[model samples]
Target: MKAELRGLPKDLAEVVAGHLVTAGMLIDDDPELAYRHAEAARRRAARLPVVREAAAETAYAAGHWDIALSEFRALRRMTGTDDFLPVMADCERALGRPQAAIKIAKEARHKQLEPALAIEMLIVEAGARADLGQQPEARRLLHQAILDLDDRRAAQLGLPAARLYYAYADVLEQTDRPADARQWFDRAARLDAEGDTDADERRDLLDGMSITFDDSDEDGSDEDGSDGSDSVEGESGEDESDEGESDEADEDEADEGESDESGSGQTRG
Candidate 1:
């Protein structure tokens, strides 16, 4: 508000400041109200680029995809910036215009964006692929995104890492690979310390849904043809291993060591 209201009359700046403050306060817990506040600010000072940006992001948070898209385009025009491309493409996806989303992504791919924004565009493109019944392509896109992050200075991709692993796990679950999905979900859970995702719940659900099988010889015999009680105990013990803990620990360290603190650019609700 300070910058955007720089040339405004004192009374007008005060009103806009109040609205923007209220919008920020409610954005996380009451997005509809926050959007209303943002709208008030936008209406009061429609010519300010920052005010328009606030309106676009608030509209997105409120699930008003069309309005968000329009405002984002306006922001692009005002600021001559391409950073908002991911959110714009995502709006296209939400509006069931996946082909349009794909076109936007293609055009933005070669443009220079921050790493976090780049990952967001990649995710939006992958989601658009899913919308087109191209789950394999979507999975492939996410998988390559993870590999790309690993190939780069991994220490700079914190937000993207969490989102990539979580998205990949979701695709794997949809493809009926629950075990692999569980592994990636665990990785995502460890990386997402802010609890931005439902990773822990997903992993817990997978654990509860898992089925245990006996690998003993037929006739209910162990290796030596003894009663299968020992085999059952062994299988139960196998389930009791610290594998999950160790895996989470290792992945957490890797995530912490490699990722920068930059946030993912998407507006979430």
Candidate 2:
């Protein structure tokens, strides 16, 4: 990003860079403010692809779908790259243009994108299909993407794999396959080490009830409302200990009786 801004006057570049930095920092929590910062940067340096890209992403984060789409389109034209295709398609989806999103996805299929970008395209296309009530088509698309995943990549359990698993799991749940959905959600939760998706919470809700995933330290006890088998075993073990103590007490009493008889006989002697 600094390299991209180097073409501008130093003072103007500094200002624009500051806005971009603020935009990025707030994009996840205060997206409206982030969008404002991005827009300010774009107003100062609209010609820069990096500025436009920041504006496009912040607009998307702020739910300014039309602005996001326009900026992404401009970025694509300026850079002659299809790297932003997934986000542009998602903007179309946000604008209630599922057909346009699908079109963008189809066009993207012909381009050579990074693996993560390709997976994102599949996710957006599947979402568009679902928006059109083509649940089966959505499931097919996501399932195919899952199947096409690079084995090494999938094994890495990176964000891309987690996202793909999450999308597939969501489609399965929507299609009324709770068991299958739960399994995939479990996979997603495991892969999403960063908690980017709510896969853990989603799996716990497969039974139409929320089940909080236990993050407590393990004491061989179930805190997730499971059948309490461990608790029962603990109780049984306590019972056995009590019975053993009772038997020991009886033996001690008999030993005392034997001692008393022996002592009485010695006294008699």
Candidate 3:
């Protein structure tokens, strides 16, 4: 269908097709550029629902949450399909409207969406609930999603699984469960390792683990200086050097005072 559409010689078709391909190429490397292409496509073919969807996706990828939301809302009205609900919910979550995300996800769930999409909705729902301080509800939702995925043998959705784990880790961290958060983060890292190897994803996962371990070491050191005994010893050595300097200054002052007193006595005599 895409190839047939691209084969058309009409100026609108050419512009739309060109922009669509360009938008996809720019999505990973430069989402802002992708958004521009998608916008161009929309301007060229305002009547095309797919063009609008592309624009919404590009906007969301570029972190323009408001623009993405507006485009998605327009698309939703035009198509009345639940295909983009997960992305819409993600935009809402990013914009700090977690409750709105939860509502959207609930609608998606009622529509009997695809398993991956449904799981994504559940993840967003959990996140929103967590943000609103509904801890038990959030946990229940997350656990339900996890169990559903497990039953479905959805490790095939490794990327989404990794994202879900990272989200769980974020929530745990916010709730002051650093140890548990680290475990989730570790899971995310392992999942990423097992999945596709995009350069950016690999770098992010590796860096995340490195930072986590570094932070753990720092925290452990603070709790029990045994972890940083070398650092402590070095600091102690510096302190001793400062004390020795102070002692030398005190002796120098005493010697100066004695010389002044002796000179005064000699002059008086």
Candidate 4:
């Protein structure tokens, strides 16, 4: 990045570099602020690929999809690589142009991309298919992508395996295949050491795991038990007695309340 900035006068380059550094620092925790920093850098160094890439990423993180799409498009043109296509397609998807996203993914498929980028493209394309109500086609696309990947390499290469599995599980759940979805969510959770895909939470949800809150009055002076406790919270007898009934209620609530995002974002390598 510093090398790219060498074209500018020394003082100007230092200022732009500082903005890029600040953007990178704030991106994960405060994306809007990060985007402001990145925009500051881009305004001064608009011709640099590194600056454009920073701007594109911060915009994407801040949920400014149109600006992200435009900046990523500029990065592609300047860098002469297809590295941004997956994210660009995703930006198109976010803008409610699923067909445009699919078209970009189609173009991406013919290009020689790295393994991770290829997987991201496939994932984005599958999502676009789902958005268009082509659930079966979406499932097939992700299924084939998973099949084509080697499991060992997926684990060792630090690939987006968890996201892939989570996306598949999400589709299965959407399609009313709870049993299959749970299985895939379990697989995703196993690979998701970083908790990137919320797979563990999803699997627990499918398993009907939940906490039962004691809704007794805060005065701690309600409910009946053989023991002299104010509430049933400490009554192991009542809890044990109601265990089976509680399980049914939990399952019902899980079914009605669980909502999921599409999938994890593309790994920002």
Candidate 4 C-alpha error for residue 211, in Å: 4.7
Global lDDT of model 4: 0.81
Q: Once superposed on the true structure, which residue ranges of model 4 sit more than 4 Å away at CA? A: 211-269
RMSD of each: 13.2, 16.5, 16.6, 8.4
What lDDT tens digits, residue by residue, belong to model 1 across residues 169-214? 9888888787788788888887778888888767755553223456
- For this target, which candidate reaches the highest lDDT against the unseen true structure? 2
Q: Summing lDDT over every window of 10 consecutive residues in candidate 1, give the lowest-scoring window.
A: 259-268
In terms of TM-score, which candidate is stronger, 2 or 4? Answer: 4
Whole-model lDDT values for every prediction: 0.78, 0.82, 0.68, 0.81
| Candidate 4 local lDDT, residue 23 | 95
- The per-residue C-alpha lDDT of model 1 at residue 226 equals 39
List of clashing residue pairs for candidate 4: none
Residues 1-269, candidate 4: write the lDDT tens digits.
97999999999999999999999999999999999999999999999999999999999999999999999999999989999999999999999999999999999979999887888888899999999999999999988888877779768644388788888988988887777888888888888888777898787666544334554545563345323332222112233223345545644643554312211211111
| Residue-level lDDT for 220 in candidate 3 | 53
Sorted by TM-score, highest first, which candidate order results?
A: 4, 2, 1, 3
Name the candidate, 1 or 3, with the larger lDDT value.
1
Model 4, residue 170: distance off in Å is 0.6
